[model samples]
Structure formats: C-alpha cells, structure tokens
Target: MLEVKNLAVNYRGVTAVEDVSFRSLPGQIVGVIGPNGAGKSTMVKAILGLVPSTSGVVKFRDRALKQQLNSVAYVPQRSQIDWDYPITVWNVVLMARTVHTGWFREPSRSSQEIVKDALVRVGMLELRSRQIGELSGGQQQRVFLARALAQQAELLFFDEPFVGVDKKTEAIIFEVFEELKSQGKILLVITHDLGTALTKCDQLLLLNKQIIADGSMKEVMTADNIQRAYGDSIFIFNREVV
Candidate 1:
C-alpha cells in the first residue's frame, strides 16, 4: 500500500538516506532495523513529508503522498514529543480527527466514537480524562498510539515504539500492532531491538546508511545481514536465529 523509490534525504549537504527503496503491502508488519545514525528515521520522515526529500518519490495506494496524507499515521519516538504539555488524553486523541472534521467544525458524534474506541484499544480509555503530564511513560506512549489509531489510517509508521517501556507494556503494544494488521493496515516500525524486530515483523529492512537487506525475516535476518547492519563493533550475545 506504500512505495518509496530512489529516495534521498539531505540535511545541509549531509545525506541521511541515500537511494533507499522499499514497498509495504497491506496486512504486513515491516521492520526497519539499523544501528544509530543509520537514517531509518530520516527515511520515515521523508515518506511522511515531515522533512523535504532531496529526491525520490513516495506513493501511497498509487497516489502521491501529498494527496494521500490522511491514509497514513506516524507515531514518532516518544523522546521527540513534549509530554509535559498540559493536555488531556481525550484532547490528544481528538486532534487526530481534526483532519477529517476540518479546522472550523467540531468533532462529530462518529469521530468522537472513533476516538473513544481508539483509547480503549490502547488501554487508555480510563485515563482519557487525565492530563498527559500526569501519566507514566508507558501510559503517555499509549496515548500517542491512541491518537494514531483514532486517525483510522490504512498505513502506520512507528519510530522506536518500545524504547523505555516495561515488558508487559511492550507486549500490549505489539498486540495492538497485531490487531491493526488483522484489520489489513500496513505497518512500518523503525526499531533498534533486533530480537523484537525478528520475532514481531513479517518483513525486515536491515540498514546502515544504506539498504543492507529487505525481505522476509527468514531471508533477511541471516547472520551475514545482522553483521552488516551492526558492523564488527557490536555483538549479539546468545543470539539464536528462529
């Protein structure tokens, strides 16, 4: 449902992503795996139009990204967000519906229902009335996810969704991903956890400033691929290929 071709992103002459290309089909979880500074996040930002690309084309369902903005949702790294903002969970989630509801119109009954359902899906329904700053880190992450879910996007992008959460919360987030996939939504998750990427994602993009490998987990998570993505400086202890 999403396609990126010959994509290159630059910041003041330093290339973040170079000639990157990939496609994501519906009902699939695609993991973009890389070490620090591998440009995984840059690639995602380019696709989402958060940053202007130096070159390349991003298409969603055969339409250019400009025309398909509503079809995709992005959950940025929690660290990038200012959780200290004084806003309720309900307000955060309701923002997602603004695109459909328009700037001047208030959220309709149907949109409100979708927002509530999204909060419930993310296990944040009870916290909906609570202030965002009052919640724990995991709860805050769930609020962001709920906002994205409320968008009802056909394609979703998550950047390091499991960074600092407990195992239980991580599992809950993965379960939410499964539910989204079951509903035929495409997911592209940029993650640093190799184990979770291998276990949870159907497809993998092993990158280190370039595309090292892209395919099914069995095909792309080989020892050689891991070595290339991580380089000789790092090691995975007791790693067993599934």
Candidate 2:
C-alpha cells in the first residue's frame, strides 16, 4: 500500500540516503534493519514527509504523501520524546484526534470511544488518568502506541519501539503488532534487533544508506546479506571458510 522510489535525502550537501526504493503491501509487517547512521531513520522521516527529500517520490494507496497524512500514524523513538511532560495517558491518546477534529472542537462520542478502545488495546485503560511522567519506560511506550492506535491509521511507522524495554515488554509489543497485522493494517517498524526482525517480520528491508536487500526474511536475511549490511562488526564464522 506504500511505494517509495528513488528516494534520496541530503543534509547540508552530504547525502544521508541515496537511491532508496521499496514497497509495503497491506497486512504485512515490514522491518527496516540496519546499524546506526545507515539512513534507516532518514528514509522513514522522508516517507512521512517530516524531512525534505532531495529527490524521490513517496506514494500511499495511489496518492502522494501529503494526501495520505491521516492514513499513516508514526510512533517516534521514545528517546526523542520529552517524558517530563505533565500530560496524562488519556490526554496523550486524545491528542491524536486533534488532526481529525479541529483544535478547538471537543471530542465527539465516537472519538472518546476510540480513545478508550485504544487504551484498552494497549492495556493502558486503567492508567488513563495517571500522569505520563508517573509511568515506567514500558508503560510510556504503550501510551504512545495507544495514541497511534487511536489515530485509526491504515499504515503505521514505528521507530525503534523496542529500544530500551525489557524482553517481556518487547514480547507484549510484538503481540500487539501481530494483532494489528491480523486486522490488515500495514506495519513498518524500524528495528535494530536482527533476530527479532527475522522471527517477527513478514518481510525485511536490509539497508545501508540504500536498499541493500528487500524481500522475504529467508531471501533477505542470508549470511552474505547480513554481513554486507552490518559490515565487519558482525561475525560470520563458518567451518566452510576453514
């Protein structure tokens, strides 16, 4: 449902990404995996139109990126958000409606129902009244996920959603992703964990400032492909080499 062609991003004359291209189909979990500074995040930001692309076209469902604004929901890296904000869980999730609902209009009954359902989906309903600063790291992440859920987006972009959380929390988040997939929503998650990406993602995009590989996990996660994307930092010992 999403297409990216010849995407390139430059920052002050330095190319962060060049000639990146990929497509994501509905009901698929596409994982973008690469090491730090590999331009994975830059590609995502360009797709979301958060950063200006030097050259490229991003299309969602036959429409340009700008026309698909509300169709996509972005869950930014938790580290980029200010945790000290005085907003409550309910307030945070409710803010998503500001895009659909005008800034001054009170949320309608349907919007409130959606907010409640989103909190419940993420298991944050009980903490709705609690301040965002009062929650733990995992809980904070869930709140953001709930906000995205409340947005009712057909496509979701998540950046490093499992960065600092514990293993149990990661499992929970994956379960949520599976549920979203079952509901036929397109999911694009930017992850650093190779093992998790191999196991959880339906398709994988191995990137290093460009599209190194893009296909099913079995096709894209080969030893050679991983080595190429990760560079010398990744060890690939083999008896065959000896």
Candidate 3:
C-alpha cells in the first residue's frame, strides 16, 4: 500500500501542488485526472523524489519511499525520453536490473531470463535488438512498458502512457495494468484522456492543484466533480464527461 499525507510542492516560490493526500492499495489502478496546470505531473514527481516537496510524506508498507527507491518503477511521459538516445530495447530493459545485478558485476542468468520474459510479455521480443529510435511510436511505448515490467517493482507509476500510441498499444497497457494489479502491485497513472478509458481505473484522483475527489469510478466521476475540477468548459451530463 501507498500512503501520501499532506503532500505539497513549490517551484521558485510558487505552489504547484498543495495539501494533496491519498492512499493507493495493492490490486488497484488509480487514475490521476485534472485540467491543465492541475499539478498532476508535479505531484508524481514529488512522490518519486524527482522534485522537492515542501511538506508531507510518501510511504509504502508504512515506510517512506525515499528509503526504498529500488522498489519503485516509473515510466514518465514519452516526451521526457530522448528517442534518439541510440540504445537498443534489450539494453533498456536490462538496465532495470542494474541495481540488483550490481554496476560492476555481471547479471545472473535468472535476471537475463526475467528481462527476456518481460520483452516477450509485451510482444517486443523479436525486436529486442532494435534501437528505440528506430521503432514506431507504439513500439517505443511497448519498450518502456517492458522495461517497467522487468523492474518487478511493487509500486509503478505511468504518466500519459496512452498518448501518441495506437489502439493496440493502449489495449496492451490496460491489459498490463490488470496483470500488475492481480499480482498485488500498485499503479498510479496520470492521464488527460476523458473518454471511456477514464472508466477503467479502480479509483480516480481528481485534482485542480488540490484533490477534488478520490473514490471509485462512479464516486469521483460525478457530474459535479467533473465540473468542479475542469470548470464549465467541460460539461458532464448523463455521465458522459467527454
């Protein structure tokens, strides 16, 4: 389980995320949804210790996540990655085990097998030697998913995974989400997609800098909640938010 208490973030004296708190349990996928400038990305960054947090704590198993960074897996928005990095799919997935394999020591056969399984699970095994830059948008996304799976972390974070991907990629991602949940892994995803995909999450965290609502799909996605988080610009009637 993951517990975030009074989490807040400030950048250059300006508050991006303020008084945000939530708890995510295993066997569930939590969606973070909000309008632009809602601090969705900032909040994820803070919890991962990629950015500074002015207040609060992020804990897993009642221990701060900062103390167990290796147990976490993060796949940031695609734009954050340089596709031109000239690295192969196999190398990227293998890097996930570097901490466990040791920087100077060679990877054990078991670790190699784990990575191969991850790639095969994502249907990218045949292209394991291809450079990420050479793959299509959907293929690139699958590569990252394979890398995260290789990590075998208890808690996973994915930011805008469906962006710029084909329908097949989107389906695979959600399928992987269910697979992870069944294994008792926690998943927190940040997505702006307001279509039916929004209904796939076990829970939704609506934000406008502060948490607007956090509950089951039916609870958090009410007409009032959508209007409150996105304003009148986005109307929600008859449960059709988009």
Question: TM-score, each model?
Answer: 0.95, 0.93, 0.95
Tell me how far the alpha carbon of residue 6 in candidate 1 is from the true structure, in angstroms, after superposition.
0.6
Write model 1 residue lDDT over 69-122, tens digit each, in one string: 887889998778887898999999999998899868989999999999999888
How does model 2 score by TM-score? 0.93
How much lDDT does each candidate structure score? 0.87, 0.87, 0.90
Q: TM-score: which candidate is best?
A: 3
Writing each residue's lDDT as its tens digit, candidate 3 over 1-242 gives 89999999999999999999999888889999999899999999999999999998999999999999898999988888998998999999999999688777798899899999999988999999999999998898898999899999999999989888888889899899899989999999999987756778888999999999999878888888888988898744455443
Residues 127-178, candidate 2, lDDT per residue (tens digit)?
A: 9999999999888888898998889888999998887777877877898899
Which ten residues in a row are the worst by lDDT in model 3? 233-242
Number of the top-ranking candidate, with lDDT as the measure: 3
Model 2: which ten-residue window has the lowest total lDDT? 233-242
Which parts of model 3 have CA positions greater than 4 angstroms off?
236-242
Residue 25, model 2, lDDT: 86
* Candidate 2 stretches greater than 4 Å from native: 236-242
TM-score of 3: 0.95
Look at candidate 3 and tell me the lDDT of residue 4: 98
List candidate 1 segments past 4 Å from native: 237-239
